[model samples]
Target chain A: MHGLFKWSSKWWPGVIPLVIFWGIAAWTSTATVEGDLAARSNAALKDTVLDKRRISVDGRDVTFAANAFSEDGRVSAVASVEAVPGVRLVNDETRLVPEAKPFVWSAERDVVRVTLGGNSPLPSSRSKLMEAAKANLGGVEVVDQMGLARGAPLRFDSATALLLDQIGKLKDGRITLTDTKVNLSGMARELGGREAIAAALKNLPEGYSVAVNDIRAPPYVFQAYKDPVALTLTLTGYVPDNNVHAAVVAAAGRKFFSEKVVDNLKASIGAPSGFAAAVVPALGALSRLSTGTLVVSDREVKLSGDALHDAAANQIRGGLGRDFPQGWQYKAEISVKPASAPVDATVCQQLFAELLSKGRIRFESGRADIVSDSAGLLDRLIETAMRCPTVNIEIAGHTDGDGDEAANQTLSEKRAQAVMDYLVRAGLPASRFLPVGYGSTQPLAGNDTEDGKAQNRRIEFVVK
Target chain B: MAALATFFWGWLLTAALLGFGMGWIAVVHRAQAVSKAWMRWLALLAAALVAASFTRIVPGRFGYWLDLFLVMFALYLCGCAIGSWLRDWVVTRSTLAARAAKSAQNDNL
Candidate 1:
């Protein structure tokens, strides 16, 4: 053992450097082989219609496991790998997934390319399908691997063409034709796309019918970007119809005083339930913000802005959600605007008028009790009052000629006092406000209709 | 007594090897735990000191001190380069292996 140790000590040091050099050479060579194999395999299979491909190298032998739609693809991949210079052998463990039946033909679209696969009845039909896809998709790559098969139903070309037309309307999804029974599953590119396709399918050639339609319409989007500095509200996205469009524009007009409404809305179908109910109140909330955005996508209302004050911000955050229709939700990102330089009494009265015009303070019928829904408007009034700190204002309450003059005057007085009391409780000085009642003496509109009466009975802030 | 002193230098070299080697291993195994670059530099300095002591390229105590300081700086730079290369290699290998495994599993399905 001692002699053996002496021999090993003498020879091992000399052998050590050689062993290390050989190890490095082998490691580098294997790394090169691995890298080369991966690159070559990817380049060869990239253009082929293979579903899944895995390439592994052990020495010079390359193993490929993949799924191919056709046997030709599998064979081609094996041949290509075998021809690569360093590869001694190719192991192809590829599979072929059976196509679904009644010979379903489908076109699938994604961000970049549209893949048209499945069975076609004739070679001419296949070419025509590819031509149509290329024509409609506009610069998107069209991959065609449609196979010729029998058993296509009567008027197959017409049905397939109809389905292909519908595919152009999809954002991402597949449309399939199974023996003249069509199945479509995907997201529509725009609002009312599903409805358009459904309407078109009703005119399909006789004997063809829809089996399943899983197509979904895009979100009912209503977005208004309020640029306070620009004094403009740019309305974009879809509204249900021309009437709804007109209503929304009028609502914007009522809420945003003197600001230009840049209407860029498209009239489309499929407005969510209670869309009007949600959007009208959302516009009211948005009007209270200094600069804000209101985005109503489906039943979700998202309002974000800098409010005029802490009271306005708190009211918006707390009240907007509850005002929406049942099952409607809201998210508010409200921040209080910095205190503005105090304005003169005249400007303060103008601001107060603008606030009141957007929304009204309400009271229980024939009583002085304020409705809880009027909190948002009152908050805005208080914010305006705080801005004009040096000014004293008279809270004048008016009534329509509906009740006795004495009772009307008393009720009006009590309502004006209620307004003053609310402002005082909200941290404003009571001395800054004077309550006054003008009974049924003066009217802005005729008191014949309810709307006219509603307009006549209002609370006005007159700067003193 | 002289032989014992030489043995002490050998022991110091061993300690230096352990310091740098263990530091490298720790960095590779748990990158977040040993994130400070200074710790890596200190370990490299320890390693270089032992190497310089063995080489004895300079004469006397001043030479020893100079060798220690200069070699520390030089090896710290070398350590950084080696550590970066090793880290990249490990990460690339892991990513490629994971991709290949996923592909193989999908192909099997």
Candidate 2:
């Protein structure tokens, strides 16, 4: 041994080769073993739900560290690594994934995009939720900020899917799920969207319950505008049904006799109760104005327009709410139309002639009772007379010469007086109106034909 | 773990082999002077390795062993120096102790 220990020149060169060869052999062998063990162990844990996995092998012994969702999962993961071929031992550094006490998850929407945040039970669930958000909210950007955690409720994926469906209906709002309870708050995109979301929540999975739902629907609106220049009473916005829609249009036609009715109302759900009843009275007040707009939103009635005079404005302001049903509110922004530039008797007479030529005042046959159909024309006559405030006007009543002459004369006199009374009730002084009876004597057209008689039977306003 | 074992064994073998080789060259061949060019080349190689290790520019998982090899190399150089000095002392003492006896034996022969 001593002789062998004695350093020799021949042995020195041989040692270099020997050491080099041993180094190469040792490195290659150990690398091969470590690499083979790692690959097999990783493959064994491929199907397991492990997070932040780290595996180190030391001569067939494995040190595995990871977060597992449950105790069973942690044990199973370690065992799977140990069962890998050539793995002699497994040092489990694994622990159960942290429990989320409340396990809150949320999806929020703004104008531009929707954001999905909070914890998810699994990676698969996280991706699934992101995909589901994209699918539900079309054309809206979906952002994901979810992390993995344990202690999620049973059927969490199903509840989240259902909740995501409601997010699309919201214009802007947030939906939060803490454990098995759901809390939602936001504004709905449309009028009936609140009810829709409420109805949808009823279908949530069995274990889940709603803790708070504060969705608000947009206002239900019904609007009418009277454009005097256009001679149109335009009705636009929502009505309860086709019947109520037709009723509102018909009321507008009746109230605004001279103005053409342009119906543009849509029949939709979520109209306030008594919508038609409220709209009709509101339209009546609107028609009494020279030009007006009526808007009914939810249970509130808002009428805005210029009344023909101060008395009419006061009447509308005080009387509009009286006809509305219980629980209905009204706000009248009534202002009297400014009095027109005073006109001389000559211009007022021509204005009456032009107005009378357009529409006739019809009275009940043989009696002096005026028909309600002529109220619009009477209002125009009153409005004209108001312009000629200083001028006294003669309200002449003519007959068609069909009835008895004495009786026609008496009826004509009474009808003329009724016209004077109507003008007086419309805030015009009674002294400005002089009742006259022409009977059949001053007929403008021959009473031989029905059309001639119809033309001849008229009430003429001659400003004096 | 296996990589560590490999590195440890390689360090021991290299140091032992280099020390033995340096001792034998010093004693038997009577060569005390080292080539300056060889020393410069060794210094350049060691500097490059140190820079690589500090910058972590060495690639592959096995590159971690570079720092270990550097330390081993430093120890091997020290072992070589000590081995050569020890070898020289032993050789000088043995030669001096046997010189007179060998010379007289030659005269008799």
Candidate 3:
């Protein structure tokens, strides 16, 4: 026993340290193997388009826990984990959550063909939908890619047919049918296409409802062209009513001064919202260009012209966008008109009249603040005045008969001064110019009409 | 009875101390490289010795074998737990250091 104890004591010290070292080595190998397997599993899972939120690694084993939107996604995730290097086994804890989305079906029309996509409840319903789409599209290739599923609302056939009928009215747009909810988005084919579709929707079958009808009518296009050589302003396109028509013509007369106004504007039902408000201000800006076109389509105003001077071009480019009503967008293409040869007083006066007739100087309503659109016109006038350097010119401001005569005169005088200030800023000698305000006493047209009132408010240059 | 009770108490205390020692060794070797199979065998041997020491409190030949098996099994578990823990610590520290170095290099650039 004594000898055995001696042997044990001698051997135990060496054995303890060796054992500890071995234990540490074993642990390191296990950890490394597990970590490598986990990394490989993660990389494999990433290659698959499955949403793997958590991954755990055991020795030669990997477990994937993820949320999948479909059965295919769940299967793919499991297969991917199994394919990882050193993974002997895979534990798939993936759960499938079928996409909970509205039952949507759409038919999109392009120039050459119509493409149909989304879900249909029944096989018969799919064929019926395709037939209807083909019938309405007429001669356009119909590519059907709609899948069949259960759970369509009742009266699906009649509702789809009604929607198909309205598709004929659209030039191009998507129609979405979710149960009883119908949403239409596209441009209308005709002038009153929106109204026609709305009227047609009212006749839908019982229990059928319209959720969102966003069909836009064709653009209500209003165009005006100013010709300085002919002293004529030609107006075209649709206006809302007869009253607006007469007012627009009279306004043209007032801005053109002695020039003739040609009215060819037609009365139509579907002018864009805020058409009247935007058109008048736009016209005021147009009157200031030498040879310019003002085109108002829907809520978009496009003005392209040559300004009478450099400063006017800058002002018009910077300010016209601001002059538009809120939510209205304006694009200006203003370039400076080239300087004309220096001329005598009489010739300069004629040039001024011609330039002014091409466009009008605009002001803020009821204020002397010159509207930015008027900058180009003022610039041209300044250029003409500079040519007749020795001659004194008079800047006259006039107002319509809307307000008190004295107040109108004061407002006109301030506006005239505002013009003179702009000219001085353009390097013109203030001493060479006189500002005068003519109250509503001088009527270019009767103030009873909106167009006439627009005409009466004017700014003129007189070579003194 | 008194002897049996003493043996039981002593065995319990010894087992507890042994467990604590093994745990400490695991922690110490966490960042060290050692053979895993050798460590597992050593743990088995230690557990068997512990069980044999407690066999004095047991009466009968069956108790001896039971004590032997139990001690060996417990020691095997201890070895595995300690070894695994150490390796994990080493790997984790090295990975963190490498990441930090790479980040510093990027920052310098």
Tens digit of per-residue lDDT, candidate 2, span B1-109: 3234443565556666576566546456643343556556756987999888666555433343454455555555555556666776787889987997899899999
A117-149, model 2: which lDDT tens digit per residue?
Answer: 999998889889999999888889999988789
Ranking by DockQ: 2, 3, 1
C-alpha RMSD over true interface residues, each candidate: 24.6, 8.8, 19.4
Ranking by lDDT: 2, 1, 3
Per-model C-alpha RMSD:
30.8, 11.2, 26.0
Structure candidate 2, residue pairs in collision: none
Report residue A54 deviation for candidate 1 (angstroms): 34
TM-score of chain B of each: 0.41, 0.59, 0.44
Query: What docking class should model 2 receive?
Result: incorrect
lDDT of 1 by residue, B3-104 (tens): 112312333333334333433443344333323464567568757766665565444323333333333333333443344445456777999999999999
TM-score for each of the candidates: 0.56, 0.66, 0.46
The candidate 1 chain A region of ten consecutive residues with least summed lDDT is: A5-14
Cα deviation of A101 in candidate 2 (Å)? Answer: 4.2
Q: Between 1 and 2, whose TM-score is larger? A: 2
lDDT of 1 by residue, A1-464 (tens): 33222222222122233334334434444455456666776677666656557888655456788766567866887777777664445667887645445777888988788999888766567889999989988888999978766566778787878888888888988887777787889899988899999998998889888999999988999999889789899999888889889999998876666468999999888899889889978988887787899999998999999887776787789988887789999999999889877888889989998888877778999999986556546867888899899999999999998979999899889999999998887778999999999987788899899998999888999998
Model 2 chain A is weakest, by summed lDDT over 10 consecutive residues, at: A1-10
Kept native contacts, fraction for each prediction: 0.00, 0.01, 0.00
Write down the C-alpha DockQ for each prediction: 0.01, 0.04, 0.01
Q: Tell me the TM-score of model 1.
A: 0.56
Runs with alpha carbons beyond 4 Å of true place in candidate 3: A1-106, A115-157, A176-179, A190-192, A211-222, A227-242, A258-273, A297-300, A349-381, A393-427, A434-464, B1-109
